[model samples]
Target: MKNAIVTGGGGGLGKSICTELSKNGYAVAVLDLKIKDAQRTSEGLENASAYAVDVRDHSSVIEFYKNYGKAPELIVNNAGIARFNKLLDQKIKDFEDVIQTNLIGSFIFASEGVRLMIKEAKKGSIINITSIHSVSPGIGVGAYSPAKAGLASLTKLMALEWGEFGIRVNAIAPGFIDSGMSKPFFENPKIRELRGKAVPLQRLGTSEDIAKTVLYLSSDAASYVNANEIIVDGGVIHSVLMHLPRE
Candidate 1:
């Protein structure tokens, strides 16, 4: 059975990714900071286990993988957080937190996971969950936009360095995915309407929509695809930019 690791699996989008992987017959490791929640998620799956990991801590990630015994064939760096504040209002701590979790954490997990996979001589796939903000920037996203942009660049770099070892690296950039983190904003009718109107699909993205893309890139169907980003934003990027000319 192919072994896979889904970081942040205790949460909404991450949980969906784990479930999708499990449905596809892979043995999944649900890695999250909350042990109880991770275990709870694993219990509902057939061939899944739980691992508690603090993605920000490199030592924690290394130890967690070491204890898991076997190298995972797939690893999704999905743990991320965004604290919104205008550049003028942003504190140093806020910027540090974003860089630490979103960018550095991904590096730590990717490094450790790749080391294990190499030791096991397994051909593996690594998926970094980035944001459309990686390309498109906005106000009140000082740290978030840069962090994701860094991740997107890192994705390409890793793919170039690891492909010779049969390791593939790619990124999934989602646009306004409807999840617990975004539910509050979507609850505001104005925000909801604006989001719908902004996208060509006239609706916000669902976690499953993003998960399906993850499944594709992790499976053999995407074997020849590497160092690329699959955007799951329902054409929002183009819609917004297309209107810029007349403004």
Candidate 2:
């Protein structure tokens, strides 16, 4: 069975990804900062295990592999944090924290996953979960946009450099998904309705929506696809012009 590691695989979209991957026949390792949360996510999934890992900490991530005993062929760099504040009001430390976890953290895990794959001589896939903000920055999202933008660029670079080894690197840019950190915000009926109406699909995206995309990218169906960013925003990002006055 193919082994896959999903960082932040404890709840929300990460948990959904774990469920989808497990259904697709991959032995999954659910890595999260909170072991209990990871365990909760892995429960009832055959061949799925949980490990506590802080993606921003190099030593912590390294320790996971040291204890895991087997290399993973597929990695989903989905761990991230976000802070909402204006650029001017956002603290330098807060901004850096977001960048470290969202951008640098993905880099650390992806690099380690690649090393393991190369050692095992396994053709692997690395999927990074980026946000639609990477292309369309929102107000008061200080560091998130830049971090995701950097991650997207890094995905391309890795794909370009590692394609020779048959390592595929790509990203999914999800817009307004109702999961993880954004769940609380969407819980507000007013905000929820507004967000739903804003999308061209006239509906909010569910965690399963993103999970299905991940499964596709990880499967042989996408064997020839690499160095690409799939936008799963229901055409919301492209609907800005439609918001203007129309005859």
Candidate 3:
């Protein structure tokens, strides 16, 4: 079976990605900071194992690759966090934590994971989970937009450097997903409806939507698709003009 590693696999969207990979016959290593959460996600799928990991720590990441982490055919850098506050109001440390988790964590994982593949002479796919905020910044999301933007740039760099070795790198930037990291925000029915209507597709995105995109990028059909960020936002990113009133 093909081996896959998904960081943040305990979270809502991560679980969906794990399930989709399991269904497609990948033996998955679900990595999360919480062992219990990771175990819970693994329990729902076949050939899935859970691990507690901090992708931000360099030594810890190296130790993981040396011990439990397999040389994966696929790696999904999905672990990230956000703090809600304006730049002036947010604590410096909170902004740092957001950048550390969303950007630095991904760098650590990709660097370590790709080293393993190099040793094993494995050429595979790496998908970074960016956000639509990477393209367009939003107010009150703290450093999330910048972190995701950095991740997008990192995705391109990985592809540029690793493509010669047949390691394809890509990204998915989801917009207004009803589940996962944005779930709490969408819990308000009125706000959810309003946001849904703002989307050109007339609905919010889902975990499955992003998962399927992941699956597509992991497949052989996408062999030539590299260094691209697919936006699965129900066309919400482009609908700002629709909301602008004009007579």
Candidate 4:
């Protein structure tokens, strides 16, 4: 069985990715900071197990991989956190914390995962979960935008460097997904409606929406595809000009 690891696999898009991967016949390791949350996501899935890991801590990540026993053929860098505050109000520590978790954390996991894959002589896929904010900066999200943007760049760099090893690295930038850290805000009807209308598809994205794309990228269907960022935003990025007032 192919092994797959998903960081931040406790809930939202992470959970959905785990489910989809499991369905596709992968034995998934659901890694999250909270063991209970990871267990919750792993409960009903076949061949799925939970592990507690803080991606920012290299030791923690390495320990989890040691215990995993199986070298993963697929690694999803989906763990991240958001700090919403204007640049003036944001603390230096908070900004650093965001980068630590979202950007550097991904670096740690990818490095470790690739090491294992190379050692095992496996051709693997590494998928990083970036965001539309990485392309278009969002207000009050001072740290998130730059962190994801850096992650996107790192995705391409990893792909370029790892291609010789038969490893493919890519990213998925989700927009207005009704999951993860954004769930509660989308629960507000007014905001949900407004956001839905703004999307060209006339609806907000779901965790499954992102998961399907992840499945595709990780499969052999994309064997030759690499160093690309697939934006799963229902055309929101390209439709932004439609919102402007016209004469």
Candidate 5:
């Protein structure tokens, strides 16, 4: 069976991706910092295992790959954190936290995952989870936006470097997906209404919406696809400027 590794597989979109991967006949490794959550997710699947890991630590990532005992055919860098604050209100360390998790941590996992796949001479797929903020600026998302933008660039770099090994690298840029991440913003009636009105689909996206795209990219169906960004924003991003109040 094909083996897939999904970082942040313990919750929300990551868990949904694991579920879809399992359904499509892939043996999945659920890696997360939350051991209990990871184990709970794994227990729900037929061919899934949990690895309590912190993707931010290179040593832990390397050790997890070693303990996994085999190279994975697919690696999804879905572990990320968001902290929103105006530049002046944001603490330096909080900004660093966003960069460290969303960018540096992703690099560590991708570098390690590619090493393992290369050692095994395996054909592989790597999917980096970016955000709509990667392409467009958002209010109070200073660090988060830049980190995801960097991640999108990293996705292309990996695709370029790993193509020789028959490994494909791509990214999914999700907008307003209803994970715990979006809960606070959506809780306010005005905010929720505005978000819904922003999207052409008239609703926020679900984790499953992004997961379905990830599954398709990992499968043979997307065999020739590489170094691309798939936006799952429900068309909000396209007409964002149109929604701005006229001067």
Candidate 6:
């Protein structure tokens, strides 16, 4: 049977990705920092196991792979944190925290996951959940943009270098999703309505939207798709001017 590993699998969007993979017959390792949340996510799912893992900690990840017993067919680097503060005003520790979890954490997992794939003779998928902020900078999101941007670049480098091992590396940049870390930002109805309408699709994205994309990149259909970062932001990146006061 196939297996998959998902970081931050306990969160709202992570749960959706785990559910989709589980539904598709993959025995999923739902790794989260919170063990209870991981267990909650793994419960009622077929062949799923919950594990507490800090994606930023190399030792923690090593222990997980050792205990779990093998490499997975796919790995999703979805563990991240957002520290919203102007670059100049933010504390250095807060900035470092975001970079450590969002960027370095991904590096640790992606590299180790690839090593396992090569060792086990498995061709797999590595999906990094980057943000639109990676390309278009957002206000008050300290270090997030740089971290994601770095992740996107790292995706290309992985594809370039890991292709020899038959592994595919890609990134998915989700737009204004109404779930997970972005959920709280939408609690104010005005902000929600304003952001929703700004999308060319006239709505915000859902966890399912990102989950389906994850499945696609993991499947054989995307066998030839690699080294690419697909943007699933409902045309928001291209609609910057459309939302302006225009005739």
How well is each residue in 74-111 modelled by candidate 2, as lDDT tens digits? 89999989999999999999999999999999999889
Judge candidate 1 at residue 155 and give its lDDT: 98
Worst 10 residues of 6 by lDDT: 238-247
What lDDT does candidate 1 reach at residue 5?
Answer: 93
Go through the candidates in order and give each one's C-alpha lDDT.
Answer: 0.90, 0.92, 0.92, 0.95, 0.90, 0.93
Candidate 3 on 1-247: residue-level lDDT in tens? 8989999999988999999999999999999998898999999699999988999999878887877646888999999899999989999999999999999999999988888787785698999999999999999989999999999999999999999888999999999998877899898999999998889989998999999999999999999999999998988888878889899
Residues 55-96, model 1: lDDT tens digits: 999889989987988878999999988889999999999999
Q: Write the per-residue lDDT of candidate 6 for residues 20-122, one digit (tens) a residue.
A: 9999989999999999989999999999999999998999988888898887789999998999999789999999999999999999988888888999965
Pairs clashing within candidate 3:
none
Best by lDDT: 4
Of the pair 2 and 5, which is ahead by TM-score? 2
Candidate 4 lDDT by residue in tens digits, 152-212: 9999999999999999999999999999899998889999999999999999999999999
Clashes of 5: 0
Better of 3 and 5 by lDDT: 3
Model 2, backbone clash pairs (residues 3+ apart or across chains), number: 0
lDDT of 2: 0.92
**Residue pairs clashing, model 5:** none
In model 4, what is the error at residue 202, expressed in angstroms?
Answer: 0.6
Once fitted onto the true fold, the runs of candidate 3 whose alpha carbons sit more than 4 angstroms away are none
Model 4 clash pairs are: none
